[model samples]
Target: MFPSSRLRRQRKAISFPAGWQIIPIAGKYWTSGAADGLGGWRWTGNLEANFDDFTKWGVGQPDSDMVKQRVALNFQSLAAVFWESEDDTMSMRYICEVEDSGTPTSPQPTVTTTTPTTTTPTTTPPPVNECNARKALFIVLESSSHVGSANFQLGKQFAADLSRAFTGLSTSKLGFLTYALIYHVRVHLHNSDSPEEIVSDILSAAYEGHSTRNTAEGMLAAKLQLETYSSGNPMHMVVLTNGVSASPSTTKHIADLANLVGIRTYAIGVSMPDSADQELLNIAGQYSDRVFKTDWARLDTILGSVVNKVCNS
Candidate 1:
């Protein structure tokens, strides 16, 4: 069964047979849940392909409603290949690619190697500790009006403490950003400075309360930052907020796309209601451990656990 949980299949180049196409059972076909800018459409079948390998959008297709109409594909008639977006739950039929596993091949001849007679001392160091391994982490804090100035300050302190905890890890890079009316990239992912400097930057940032919570745009910014500056390191993001987004569906869709691109995201909901916590789950990619809820005063108490998960999870 195709697992819906996987936002996108393993990404790689896929080869299709001649005249290969997806024939709709009735009206339209269900294709990938890939929109335009969140890393172009891709083949998610058993065989894989590049991000843009299967893109062929119809005229004015793949519309702005990225959350609902995310599936992209083409029609079978007229020798046409114009992809279009459709709802994923629409009971439409599509093709599935399955790899052959029954064939057997001859085994290769065994070879042996001899140990070197001379020995030399090497200067290579041991592997970096997993908890301190190289990675790119982006922290996004919500600075909307719902998050009062006191709680916003608490969020800043929490971010500062978190950055300080990961300081001194030469390879691990951390950045900071805040979201409300607009998202600000206070620290870039490529900032190669001391953790103390990063902490200072975070603590010094001004939290001008915004009238709206544009978490989706903030997450998209974080995703772009990772894509541009992660240098192929493990990408992780932590979002701390107390209010629901002005566009929750967009926020959730962006989170889904981020997860598709291998961005591990975590969410912290500070003194949020049940409805808002649901949004936090979406931001966390619906992973329980990745979603933490607490009052603003106790936000720092979960620092240890968040750090542990960031390092080990």
Candidate 2:
């Protein structure tokens, strides 16, 4: 659903079949909760998009009070306006244009197989143990406009999968919440539920808000929760975000503080590689092995990595 500005402009110039009156535009303008940086009528979103070129806007359009909405083009008016729906999703007919409109090429995993020579008998080394089963895990998710309803729900499912993966492990505990302008406790700390119960709670969690993201506040809140239930276990956190945080300085400070306190963090930056925040590496600490980034649509694929690293680091 996330298209680029160049593609949107192309669609605007192209001809569509009948009944395709409304189309979702490339960028999203997040002005829902509070006026963070939305300068009245000025557009602000998707740094890669050409929002500065505003020749396609409707007359006095984009005046919506909501902050977490995206843009849609009106074929009849030849203008673009903010689109919203009752289910918090794009309800209009959409144009699906393939970026690579040819035969697709997917990456294949490389495999290496070698036959062992019987010249000398070698003893196999003992399997190295990396699992830190008794770790307390906290996952802080972003529920801002940066992550729309679809992706936000997908994120919850991703968390649920990760939490469930740790189930049956001797000493794994999971705590989770969403942080926008403020954080909400979807699943509280010290919840002595089985792994299955924790996963159920996460899967059923709802989006708290579409406000601006407060990453620092989320990290701080997670730190407090982890402290309460840590019980001397190795602590870990998986924080997922789709955009730059509302408080970068504060987030960095708190991340540093958490690191000093022996809390290992796994930063999951979900967005296009170029658009995603590179600060995630810093947040994940010196071990780059724990940092991860993925397109918003592909966030679920990283759920396994998050669960494995947090539970077995």
Candidate 3:
């Protein structure tokens, strides 16, 4: 059994396949299967094989579903899992290829922007000094049909919790955006009045669902609304999705826009399979310095951690 005291720490450090190498929806140690179940492939090498053999040498049976099917094996103590298959004489050759993790050591830092337009200095803006400068935190809840109820509920809970926590801070503003069949980015309030109002707004947003899930359109709308409502205040985005974009180019363009606007994005994957838009999520998170994964049970904790990271940073 895993150590009880260290479970949380271990979970935070758990390593998974990510990066450009896994881009275009492919990985070196990837597995491919078909409906016929006759033609399949597992890619790995001697180094990975040896590591897997050594790690699983005396461990009776791995507890993971992927490991039980022999689709993955822990190659090292560094939380790296090697992809492989169980059948040896099925005429399915497991190819080996060199690969890297591709994830950055730390989250990407926030970027600043420069505009070409210039204006003559009149008053110099008084140095913009304010110890209690408020920041606007906009959460776009995609009630699109593409997103499941479980994801929507989790997003609502996260937004409520964040609003509550920030309400206590003197220099924080919390806002809510809910997208329905059409993109509707609603700002519950400009600046928070109380935690109860914030919670109510989140619940009301969840009650409304959009026709389809168009994250790109929703993100663009949210950016525009934030620009109009918050003005000079900083804005951060937290997007939750299970599947990949129907349009890859659109997703890339939105990611670029977020990066350009200094909007920190935290992408949350809820009940999404490893094969579903993992690369896009990683890229989005890489650009915004906030990518995470969790199911319903642990989503609240994940949101709490994310808020702390972004607010403190």
lDDT of each: 0.70, 0.61, 0.50
lDDT of 3: 0.50
Question: Which 10 residues in a row give candidate 3 its minimum summed lDDT?
Answer: 34-43
lDDT tens string, model 3, 1-313? 1223333545455464465232222332222211111122211111111121122222543222221223433243334434444321133333332233444254458999955532222222112112233566667665756665655666676666666555555556666776543244444335546666666656556334434455564565555445555656677766666556544455556666665777766677765677865544643645434777776666666755766655754
- Where model 2 places Cα greater than 4 Å from the true spot, the runs are 1-132, 272-276
Model 1: per-residue Cα lDDT over 21-50, one tens digit each:
744443466653443344455333321233
Give per-model TM-scores.
Answer: 0.59, 0.56, 0.51
Error of 1 at 129 (Å): 12
The per-residue C-alpha lDDT of model 2 at residue 177 equals 85
Scored against the true structure, residue 65 in model 2 reaches a CA lDDT of: 35
RMSD of each: 21.0, 14.5, 21.5
lDDT of 2 by residue, 1-313 (tens): 2334555765555554556565544544322121122232222232223344443445655444332223454443324444331111334454343334444344458999966422211133122333447677888988887788778777877776666555556666678988886566667667788776786677666676655677766776677667667778788888988877765665776787788888998888887365444568656764678888887777766665666667666
- Off-target runs (Cα >4 Å) in candidate 3 are 1-134, 188-192, 206-211, 277-285
- Per the 3 Å backbone cut-off, how many clashing residue pairs does candidate 2 have? 3
Highest TM-score against the true fold, candidate? 1
Ranking by TM-score: 1, 2, 3
Arrange candidates, best lDDT first.
1, 2, 3
Point out where model 1 deviates above 4 Å: 1-36, 39-130
Model 3 clash pairs are 44-96, 180-210, 181-210, 181-211
Question: How many times do residue backbones clash in model 1?
Answer: 1
